[model samples]
Target: MKKLLTYIIIGSACFSACKKTEEQLYTAQDNIYFDLNFKDLSGNNRRMDSVMYSFALFPEKSVDTVWLPVRIAGMRRSEARSFRIAVDEKATTAEAGKHYKSLEKEYIIPADSGVAKVPIILFAADPALTSKSVRLKLRLVPTEDFTVTNPEYDSAKVIFSNRLEKPAWWATWQGELGNYSRVKHELFIRAAGVNELPVAFDAQVLPKVLFAIRRFKNFLASPISWVADNPQEGYTLEPAGAGKYNFFSITNPGKKYLLELNPADNRYYFTDETGARIV
Candidate 1:
């Protein structure tokens, strides 16, 4: 009998506390924070004021959605509540409905939920991404239902681009591919459908990569026309063995250069009078 009385007293106190909290929730102010994180293709973990996105990494994707995580500081009510967010036009470089989709009329924190996401949609179709990057800056707007909270997480910026960079592992292809160039890297991505080669290197893509290499070689060797046009002044290249060649000077045949792929190691150099390597 005593234990039953104690249970009833504890249950009554819990009910009173919940009722009090329910009453205070309507009077208290709710706040929303623009919490964001950066998860780029670099595979590094970091906390940043801005998020970095690249369309180059996802060549096939025409559009990408970046979620702006928002946190509610106040109580979670039973009824769905709407909040507002605004983009700072002065600080933003990306245009609405062009570079990125416009924000919705309002964002909502569903009933009994303390978190929500505001999406910033980016379009890779913009030619600007190919030459330069664009930035979308957003901040929480205080409305009747919710107020902006936390200075650190009050604003979020997303920097997106389609610019290309040389892969760190490009040195591995020197012996086979000869040298690195911007045009070559661009061709490599189109052939491999990837920004960087995989560590294991899938054998299936070898033929496509070889095809791309052949195209690169054709581009570099296109001066066959110029040489033919100016045969008197243009030096003629004589093929040696094993993809190696001798560039004999047209005016001074005594001077020759070994046109060779040194695998990025200093092995190719000017030849002596006897066509022997100077080094």
Candidate 2:
């Protein structure tokens, strides 16, 4: 009976301990993480600790920005909240201001957002980057507003350089801009304001395209003037109307042939009264 009582006491103690642990687990705080496995401006998702950047890709830009993503693993709140990040100086090789702009004291995760991005501003005008790459490491610090749950994503790194090199995809776009040269590439970046073509256009693109179409319609609606090359030979070409033409022939005074300009090819061709092309 004494042994039985001892077993009951031990079992009750174990059950109580387990119940306490389960309650604590249920009440554990939701946390934020860097979500290193994320997508950037290129829209390609990569699981990496460090991101690489080059200023040469945007030669005309004095500064550039790339967004690093952070995510929350639990329920979102109704209001925006701030989080903390700091430069891990010992792990960083890039200089502040010269290599990269200083980060804000805090970043915001909008209300109801499961994910957020921290913008990393990189200096493109640094001459040293042309010769060597510099590194910047940023650590996610726990604050009253946020706490890091995963040690793996507690920090992120970026390696950057100003050295310009022709992108591999240049092979596909070279013909559109002609041969690639340092000067030409810079000009292309300046003119286009982007390193790559925008493959996916949003709603804003439609209005500009429509505006261009309107301009083109105005051009087509306007009359085109063509002069008879040999006016001395009694050949006079005048605009009759769209699809109709009048050509004055001296030899056959009553024989009228319509001369029309093909805007598609910017060439002139003669058509008979029946609208058949005269070869």
Candidate 3:
């Protein structure tokens, strides 16, 4: 009887201890509710900031989706919470089903979770995007569980662009290259019959000009005189707009010449030493 009594007492104490702990946890949970914010692509939530998703693609490009995540700061709950998203039509340039798939109206922050994602799939090799960039502005609405803490970053901007983007090198000496902007660069690349063009500099071979040499022969219908100098060097040229080649001729400095890809003649024409077309 004594042994049975001891076991019963121990069991009763354990039950009360469990009940007390449960109540404590519930009370703690009730005291906490955290601010909700949009997480950047890096998964860090420093501020509720607008998100930008940008991409460039070539023909026969593969389609892909960019995921934007939302985050909350407190304890996880068993019940799901919903957040609302609406397209800001006045601010958006992308049409639904053209640049991106239309986003759903609501996304759920799943039970016991602090983060959720909204997937935006951008179509690949979009011919329209080649000439221009399409923008989709998405605004987050006030929900029962969450409100915008910062008005500035309460929306998202999605840009689907395939236009040629100038390389990082241009940030320093773009003016010398005839103020080559992204659009101009895209035009040059497209005319050259290439998807992309990269600028390369080598002090050993030529320091003043950036050289990107490759299968120009395949792209061009016929050969030019410059091919004798370096067959690989003149495959594609960026007429740094204003009728000037993108490269500074090593043999001629401080003098920029005009290079035109003459589709009619099936040849590239550049002004020679005497300002005559060297075909």
Query: Which candidate comes out best when scored by lDDT?
Result: 1
Question: By descending TM-score, how would the candidates be arranged?
Answer: 1, 2, 3
**TM-score list, all predictions:** 0.56, 0.52, 0.47
Error of 3 at 246 (Å): 26
Residue pairs in candidate 1 whose N, alpha carbon or C atoms collide under 3 angstroms: none
- Please report, as a residue range, the 10-residue window in candidate 2 with the lowest summed lDDT: 218-227
Model 3 RMSD vs true structure: 11.7
Clashes per candidate, residues 3 or more apart or on different chains: 0, 0, 1
Which is better, 1 or 3, measured by TM-score? 1
Once fitted onto the true fold, the runs of candidate 3 whose alpha carbons sit more than 4 angstroms away are 1-55, 58-62, 124-126, 170-279
Clashing pairs in 3: 216-235
lDDT by residue for model 1 (19-84), tens? 999888778798888656556789775557898887666544667898888888888889989988
